[model samples]
Target chain A: MPDTPAIEVRGVTRLFESRKGFLFREHTRTEALRGVDLAVRSGSIYGLLGPNGAGKTTLVKILSTLLLPTSGSARVLGHDVVEDSEWLRPRIGLVLGGERGLYNRVSARDNLRYFADLYGIPGGEREARIAAVLERVDLLAAADRRVEEFSRGMKQKLHIARGILHRPEVLFLDEPTIGLDPKSARETRKLVRSLVSDGVTILLTTHYMFEAEELCPEIAVLSKGRIVAHDTVAGLRQLVGGDRTLEAEAYGFDDREVDAVRRLPGVSKVVSEEYGPRTRLTLRLRSLQTSPDDVAAALPGHSELSVRERRTSLEDVYLDLVEEEAH
Target chain B: MTTVEVPRISRSRATSASLRLSFLMFMADPQWLIPSMIAPVVFGLVAFELFRGSGPYYLTYAILGAGMMSMWGQTLYGSGWAIGQDREFGTLEPTVQSPTPYVYVVLGRVLWNVISGLIGGGIVYLVVLAAAGSPPAVPDPVGFVVLFVFVMLTLASVGILFSAAWVYTRYSGFIQNVGEFAFYVGTGCMFPVVLLPFWTNPIALIFPPTWALDALRYLAIPGYVGFGWGFWPDIAGAVATTAIYVAIASTVFKRVELHVLSKGDLSDY
Candidate 1:
């Protein structure tokens, strides 16, 4: 890999104006990105881990030249995002997650072909490039199927095909696995790994910490428009220590109990996920001194609650940083 | 896998490629072709039947008016309404983000709409010809064809302009539908603009499509056929108006591009 960065962002900020209220009412301003600075080395998979509203997509948009930053600047392949956008655009590919960006009526191959032409792929080489990408994404068998007929996973694979069709040096994937089945998400990660191994730089954003841990060499944790922590997957896990964690499973849990657990002393973070009829809460305590008893005492319905000490995953690291601001 | 060099398309090639994709996208849903053909002929039939006793002029007038309506449909629905559809399809963000200038894609989209308008116009002419029992001949086919081409181009430019300007409103369908119907009646596509109340003539005259429709009448309608000032002015006015609208469209597109990029929301990205 080259020492020079494939993607560089310096002090980028984007402010969105809310268009609410009548003619005389003032428009409100919301800061989507606040002076974020990041850099990704060439031929590396860089993951941005954040919950929704963390400005991960905002930063991705600015770097992809889809949205312009209100202040500061971002550059891709050494071209200024705002100034050299026209020149820089062809050099990068983007997969904005969960949107029906492809023409549903057209076959997957045709969709890739159309984007191929737009990217300046000559007619002679376009077929090969399109097919290569489809094969890489494991969508070769369904290449001629209309995009609308494809499942969510298939559509995502097609998007991956389109992104890599031009052989871009950098690929921007925002929440690439948000709605995919496990097998599809696993396949996508494999494709991403292959692309990076081929010396293509990838910038990925996702709420799935394990996906980040599995696929990305480095992960940046963004919370409410700022980067709170950035490090390698294992290094991030060590921030809260893998051993000092508490897991609680409760029956018939609701938001009120979750909020109540969040306010308990020594509790630094809280992440809740529903499994079947029960809710699993992962809480990161302030220190090793904090105990499972402290958590059990805070439980709303103790009769049906179970608490245990466990090792921390990447999710614990993310929740620790983001919920720090929430508390 | 062997790595290949990043692709690069020339600016002209980009525009043409965009045109090809958008047209293919239209054809991909072949059902769309039906309404384009049906709307004009249906309108022509109703209008022609209403004026059956008037003379042969009724058939020529109904066919011409319906043809213009189809062209306007191309501008309104194909160009303007398509913008809304693109947004709904979630394709707008990707297209805008592509290296190719979005204006070219929009230009290409309108161009195909112009082509669809021609198809609709042809169907209207044939249907009216069959019903009227004779084909209405243009006194000067060359002059009529020349004017018709310019009229289509001018209307196309106007559609491109509307596509750009309507990005801000987000409700492109409602806006373009209102514009299409208003201009159809206002431009005298179904009747003579001069016959409209004294107040609407100036409003109708400002539209390039209105002037083009008048030029078409001068070329095809036997009683109105001529090479005089009455005839040449509409051609000149349509061409000049088209040029001005084209310039405005390009400038507005640049501004909107900047605005959307800077202030765009998540959905836009």
Candidate 2:
């Protein structure tokens, strides 16, 4: 039981149907999720990285029991998401962060009170629990303020506050730090870390690569309704071909020059892109055997040639995986 | 690391909390009451003017008609509107995601609407009494009060069933609005079902409010010939129809919940 994954998804797919036209209806079906499989360990933060419309929100909604998958199955803490939603609901906290999904007219405290009751938080501890979550989210000062008057950041904080008010065993955060200032976003990331320390398994969806690299021990890259890659930051960097990236730029690179650079020792992949008149070849290396000098040596006789080497980042890994999936 | 023990969901607690939340929302913006009151007051004045010279018991008919109309607006339209607000507020998903069943939440709103509908009914009573210059003569005042409350229960049952439509679609409010006057005419809110075409009576009888309102009229108006079946059968019909509505509401709410989940459109509005 201890080794069992906190969240397990297997070949899960979701399709959305829409009808257009008034008199003669034309039905269209969209595959929001496509045979997605994933596993998140307990007491850990797992990051889901994807471009827009990559089915991150759809996956989160399905895991949170707000939507059902059309095929396959997903389970949280050993309970099937579809069949055991009611049993799982109280134990799972969901924060689909945005400007909406809050009672704008009522005080933040009142909104929490309403949800606390809905979650069946004991009457004896309801107020204290609300106060604790507000304090945890740093909204204690604005607890009595109407949500309509709160800033976007404050509303997001309240959304988190509501999510964790019940102290769920698992929490699903869909872009929790979106639209937040640096300081607020850092605070939210810190809050997420703290929740994990408290033994909450978190499946976090974020567009920020740095945030994912910093918080999640394991990350999954989703593209076009499918999981292209799932690994730790280092594992992802390795999967995308290496830990180091070398950039070589010149006015033009012939096929022979490009092939020579691609054949260099430790060079796993070489991607070329055109910027106006110059072509930039980005080489991913698995080992440090290939250096800037080596790259420059491989493509000689070019006065405009410039070679540089740096560590491959999570951003590079994410882009590589997403682009590969797109192709 | 505070651990939250999963608490058992109490349907009664959820319903009561929903009722309290609705009350708080209403208090925050009391202007909503003005629009809800307008229809009832207009109906009361119009009915009293038409019934003033008809007969001695005509005042009772007018008051009953207006009162039932007022409760219908509150218990039915108001309950459905609460759900529509949930959709617009983006709260429907979280509320549905909670451990509490959606029916309990709707029941809470219906309960609040029933209370407000009574207030609307009381307002109509005062407005009609003022217009006619005297209260309707009643042989059994206690029975009238009891029957009025029962009529609201019938309306509450129908309201519960109607609120499901709001959950089933974002366009439900428009559908309800278009059907509003039809419901009034069908249920014979401003007149007895018998006064309409004989063919319409069977259709009207399906609505619990029709049977309940007819019984209320029988108790309030002497020589009232509703169904020509007297008081007991009217009460029986109201009870049977109300039970059916409640049963259908339970099943329909479950299906609506599933439909929204399968469609994944709880927040589409």
How many collisions per candidate? 0, 0
Q: Against the true structure, what is each candidate's TM-score?
A: 0.86, 0.96
Query: B73-150 in candidate 1: lDDT tens per residue?
Result: 776578876677677778888878887777877887888788788888888888888888887756787777677777
Candidate 1 stretches with Cα past 4 Å from truth are A23-26, A241-310, B1-6, B28-34, B223-228, B266-269
- Taking all chains together, the TM-score of candidate 1 against the true structure is 0.86
- Which candidate number has the best lDDT? 2
Residue A317 lDDT (model 2): 97
Q: Give the best candidate by TM-score.
A: 2
Candidate 2 structure quality by residue, lDDT tens digits, A1-327: 678888999999999999989999999999999999999988899999999999999999999999989999999988999999988999999999788888888899999998999999999999999999999999999999989999999999999999998889999999999999999999999999999998899999999999999999999999999999998899999999999999999998999999999998999999999999999999999998988998899899999889888899999999899999888
Give the alpha carbon lDDT tens digit for every residue of A123-211 in model 1: 88878888888888999999998888999989988888888888788899999887999999988888888888888889999988889
Candidate 2 iRMS, in Å?
A: 2.6
Looking at model 1, residue A151 earns an lDDT score of 92
